[model samples]
Target chain A: EADIYQTPRYLVIGTGKKITLECSQTMGHDKMYWYQQDPGMELHLIHYSYGVNSTEKGDLSSESTVSRIRTEHFPLTLESARPSHTSQYLCASSLGRAETQYFGPGTRLLVL
Target chain B: QKEVEQDPGPLSVPEGAIVSLNCTYSNSAFQYFMWYRQYSRKGPELLMYTYSSGNKEDGRFTAQVDKSSKYISLFIRDSQPSDSATYLCAMSGQREAGKSTFGDGTTLTVKP
Candidate 1:
């Protein structure tokens, strides 16, 4: 089993508020990714990290920012929340590019 | 057209019925195919992963891949209520294995 965790299982906040979604894995993985998913929709990659100090933007464009200061911690930050940002954020980690990605429980955000 | 296509089926079936989920891709470069299951308010869990082609069976789940047809299938036998969830199909190539293309998930309901 993958030991990945996300904090704030559910979050509801007003527009213009800042929020941070936390993701951490104990698997000592080198490749971590962040995906945005709407209900029943395909997952869209937002950001990804190769390792510590190596972060890259994903296929989808997003206003959120991500950081990779530690190998195990990968956090996503939204400077100002909007209704459009209301969706589910999923975090996954894998040992390498060809490895299976294990996901967290996900963090649901509602920007009202 | 999208690279991966999956029928966003809200398929419902009774317990003990056989469930088949399928996905077709336009990209032949994709060598890796995967199936994931996501519960309500939770992240996706990788249920099966296949490299190349052929059929792989695990317990009550069976995964089949036909690279020539650019098609993949997932079958669940003796489906139970706990098997109800959104199923997602993802694929990637050897060049960029972690940058997978995903299909819109299919929602399934298994009634007991």
Candidate 2:
């Protein structure tokens, strides 16, 4: 099993509600990433962090923002959720750039 | 154009049959290739990782990378029913900041 952990394996929320998806890694990895995936489809990189206080947006445009105040923690926040935001969000971390990445269980979000 | 391309296959095969999954990448700068397996409603798990060109074997899984052709493959020997899942191919450059591009996963169903 991977060392990364994501809370609320499943979540259903109303539209326009503020939500935060938590991701934490105990493996002491420096590189963290967030990906959004539709059911049985490709995963799109949404956000990533190289180290503390360093975060960058990925190829895909996302309304959410992420912060990396600590090395082991990278949380994604959506100020106001929408129906289009319903998807599976995966969290992963790697020790370095070219190393193997470990993924968390993922958080499934549903907006109604 | 997208950096990585893969067949979104619902490939069905009998148990104990050898399974082959492949992906093609457009970026010549990509040197690290990886394959990840994701179960239903779960995050993806790394199955194989290879650097540059060559083949690497681990247990029932073998990863092959061809830098010249910008192609990579994952072969599973003696596939079992438990091996049924979505296989995703990912690749990226050496830089720590470069985002890893993932292909649309191929779903495999192994039947006994």
Candidate 3:
């Protein structure tokens, strides 16, 4: 099993609340990604990082931000959570850009 | 059109039966194809990966890629209830930090 982990496997919050989803890995990978998925839907990449201090937005426009302050840590922050932000957030890490990625257990958020 | 397309199947199969899942892509530039399995609220886990075209088999799972037709397939033999999960197909081109495009997952339920 992969060593990647996401904290607070499930979260329920109200609108306008600030929330941060934590993702960490012990694989020493340089490429990390964050994707949002609805129930039985396609995954939409929201943010990704090549390495520490390198972050980029993905194809899907999102209201979240991420920071890669450590190679093993990538955390996403939503300044103001809304009902539309309710979805499962997945974190993944790969040895390289095109390599197979290992995913965390995911955090399911329910914003009311 | 979406880069990758897959039927969102809530497919039900009996135990010990063979299950087939498929995905189609519109991007010819994609050089890597992968299959991921996600259980319940967990993040997706890589099940199989293929480069270019042809077939690759691992244990009870077989992955096939056909670049000419822009189609990919995954077959699971003797599938069990434990194999019940959502299957996602992903692909990406050769680029540094290339983001992968994913198809809407197919949910499989292997009944006992």
Candidate 4:
């Protein structure tokens, strides 16, 4: 099956805790993206990767960092979580720059 | 001003009604337009996609793009209770299509 997966659909943790959100896709897509979306707000691009060993920061600045060691994996790590960092993280992938995108279930993180 | 603008509406309609969702963008470079459906606490699922200025249809959904007017629309016919979700509009430029701009989703509820 061609799909993208995100681990820990829901997470709750105290502030200042370090956390990593995992995203993997079996579709062999060249373009992968991570987006942050809050309630009733638009999605903000946080990070993206074109392929293995290629990663770039998106339009929105964030304290989180992403690594694309392999083509299938793109993980986002927050050095220290804060209460203001609580939001849903979505993962998406596409075959080409102008193609349609497929999304994963997403991970909802809560920093108390 | 924002590049893309959408009405974040909590629109309610009876079953079998036709639903219309719209989005406007300030960037004329955008040539790839898409519509996505997102359930509560779920990732967005692609519903329809169109290139340049034209209409594309699948099942009960139709997506329209007007590059000259810098506008796009999605129409859903015979709305059902299962259609209750948030509709999002996204677009990217043809030359620079890797990154897509998304609109603040419009929440819709279909009653029986």
Give the whole-model CA lDDT for all candidates, comma-separated: 0.92, 0.91, 0.92, 0.90
User: How many angstroms is residue A79 displaced in model 3 relative to the true structure, after the best TM-score fit?
Assistant: 1.0
How well does candidate 1 score on lDDT at residue B98?
74
What TM-score does model 2 score on chain A?
0.97
Per-model TM-score versus the true fold: 0.96, 0.97, 0.96, 0.96
Candidate 2 ranges beyond 4 A from true positions:
B96-98
TM-score of chain B of each: 0.98, 0.96, 0.96, 0.96
Task: Give the C-alpha lDDT of model 3.
Answer: 0.92
* Best model per DockQ: 4
- Give the CA lDDT, 0 to 100, for residue B27 in model 3: 85
Candidate 4 scores a chain A TM-score of 0.95
Evaluate fnat for each of the predicted models and list the values in order.
Answer: 0.70, 0.53, 0.70, 0.70
Q: Write the per-residue lDDT of candidate 2 for residues B1-112, one digit (tens) a residue.
A: 7789997799999999999999998999888888999999989999998889999999999999999999899999999999999999988787643367889999999999
Give DockQ: model 2: 0.63
Docking category of candidate 1:
medium
Interface RMSD of each: 1.4, 1.9, 1.7, 1.3
TM-score of chain A of each: 0.97, 0.97, 0.97, 0.95
